[model samples]
Target: MGFLNAVGNVGLALSVAQVATASFYIYLEWYAHGKWTGHPGMQEMKKIAENISSSSFSTASTSSDELEFLRSHPSPEGVASSIDKEFRRMEKFVAFAGRGLTSSWSGRRIVVTPSWILFSHRTTFLPICQLLGHLGAVVVGTRCINNQIASLGEDEEQERADPMLGSGVVMATIRIADMDSGACMLSFDLPASELENFRLYLCCPLVYAQGVSLEPSIIQRFLEAFSAVVQENEPIEIPPSMELERCIGCLSNQTSVAIRRSCAGECGSCRCRPMWCEMCVGRWFASRLAQSHVPTSEWVASRVPCPTCRSLFCVRDVISLKRAQY
Candidate 1:
């Protein structure tokens, strides 16, 4: 009986050790992947880790046989498979829940909505630690990469004098949002001045690119602690579209003022209008149409009949309706 009891104690210790080993490997996998792939893969791994945590607890609690099996069979491949499956499930959840959360958070939560798309040029680390120090965004994540901004030259300064060019400053794309809600604000031609804090103060190359949406609570907290290195609010100068001749709406003498949804579809352009304007909707349609079997000629015609909808409309009309509120 004494020997049998000793064997049971050893089995329990082995089970505990197996759990610890699995956790360590999982952590290593996530740490390695996060640096390579950025936040999306990290988030996916977090979801996987949560699943493993639950499974470990449940197996230890209810089923000793299952726990023993995992310990004896000990397959790293099995652990990896489990992680991948959980990520697939998260992708499905995002597909349905992403849009609504993005919109709601942007409208209600963002305190100071930036008009620039922010990108970090550093390719080494997830901006989480820095962002958490600067702003605690829960849903949105930022990555840092190394990129050099060019110094302004005489020729570039000359172009700035032209009304078409507006300012000598080069525009940047930036994304800012509440982390939890997934609501994001994208500014394509944001002023270089707004990023002064990150560029000069943070001593990191920042630019614009795609990023994960974070929850608002996380962002709010992050900003609260973020050091305000630059206090000067330079009024940004935005240039008019010079592509007027090639644009159907501009050629047709429609409203030259183009209102678009930067992140929250809350503005009149996104909410009141039945469809998105040619500016907002056409770009996406053009890419999708290019890949599809649709004829190029059909896209340029002013009042071509849409084979898909059987509706008669001009080039401008179709583009507008294509982006209309659905």
Candidate 2:
């Protein structure tokens, strides 16, 4: 009976110790938040924002591409202004131009401006992190098959049915790494047609093309074959009567490629007229290779079907169409 009582006391002591440790951790977190020191926790983020806003303001004041809002829109005279107050500009960019990817229900919602990128939790909408700039960007996943959204309203249904749906330029995960280090600081899925938006603001090099999309992509030169095929194929002149239409793949760029079999292989020829742009078709080829579960080395030798006609053709078969002289 005494031994059992002693064991109970030991258990009580361990529980007390755990509670004390937990309290110490909570105290440390509170201190890390700068509540005790009376200093801002986000000093570095604030400074980065300030620097970007000041630089943008100065450039707008000097350049021909000056924003009209800075002049007509009034702020307090002699008071330093911050771009954070350009709420309308930021909102407009988000609504109309669509700068970044976001989620409504859960996970992080991101917003990117020329000045800074903010990631906030969907629940509370409080910022998770703010990035002023990035070193380089890389995209990973199946992108060879570009899936144009059939209906914007049915996007949710489509995603649920086929998780591999590739909408817009890329249906892939994008990871942004720090300038000073290769460690990924931000990772997000690029929304449909938002790839160009990322390019416009961030202007970061595709680490994938630099052979750094994956750790193995560097040694394997994963993107080299796909890139080479597109660059090497000479442009085909379009007939004067043939109208240049919007690319079926991106629904944005003009259709500039036709799948004309120019290779010496067993691959079938495509009868379809130019329906995809150079970039989109290349992406389609890459997507096929990605889905094949084959090594990147074999991708260049593989054949892909035309998005419309379904006729199989090698990468070399994609020829850019030169707009007729009008």
Candidate 3:
């Protein structure tokens, strides 16, 4: 039954892909033929273009009359508006494709695109996948978790047996799978709160697969494991002892004495030496959050890992360091 369902989903996806590809090519050809050149909005655009061309040929600044004309014309703004409208249309087509593909599958749905399509149009495809990913959808060619089953505990079993018990009760089976690898990563029956973090982690690419949940402590462990893996695969380079005294993030000699005291023993008792200033670390944290595809608002509460040691630290920790006195 599962094999049949999978085959059906593949056929549906192929059909949707064909429709989308045809629509995109048709629109491109139409656009190339200047079908929209005679649009009613073009009259104002033509006037603006004439004014701009004339301005380019003249050395003297335009008079107040010309400035007013330019302001009223807003040719550049009009062009941008048209481009935005077309982009929205394309976005709608992609959304429609995603929805149609998802509805054809049972259980958790995953949308798989040909590797050629992904490589050729990654910029367009990534955003669409990201949108679907946020809504509990999975995209192919990335790590994901899928169909996990967990056994119910005795108390939970009794709750399920009770006819009076309502839908408020959490289920025993918690399934999570990696869509890219097409393998189930977690299947244990954990609390829903704990499970929520795993879901969030899967949707974002900042963290790698570690066969664990997303609690701060658990994430720290994952980072440590990741660091070990990275270290094993790469050659190690020992920094000079003098360089170690400066901030690793900014290479600044100015260190915050107060932060060192406050965060004492927080970074683990590694005698390897602490080499980051408060301000530098703060900036580094901000940069990581900015680089992440996950929405900033969503990650504001998340902890950041150290660039040097992969030790997980919170924004508050970095902020405190930033405000620390000598």
Return the TM-score for each candidate structure: 0.21, 0.36, 0.21
Q: Report the candidate with higher TM-score, 2 versus 3.
A: 2
Tens digit of per-residue lDDT, candidate 2, span 84-141: 5433352212311122332221344556543334555432222211223335667744
Off by over 4 Å in 3: 1-244, 257-272, 298-300, 319-326
lDDT tens digits, residues 209-264, model 1? 44643233322322332212111112212334323222221122332222223322
Best by lDDT: 2
TM-score of 3: 0.21
lDDT of residue 170 for candidate 3: 33
lDDT score for candidate 3 against the true structure: 0.35
Model 3, 1-326: lDDT tens digits are 99999999999999999999987775665344665443333443454445444644244222333334444444645433433443443111111212211111112222212100010122122111121111222211121112222223422321121222223323223333434455643232322222222232122222224353333433333334433432333222343332334443333345431122113334432222455554444444444553454564555355556555556655433321123133
Model 2 TM-score on a 0 to 1 scale:
0.36
Query: Number of clashing pairs, model 2?
Result: 3
In model 2, where do residues sit more than 4 Å from their true spots? Answer: 1-224, 324-326
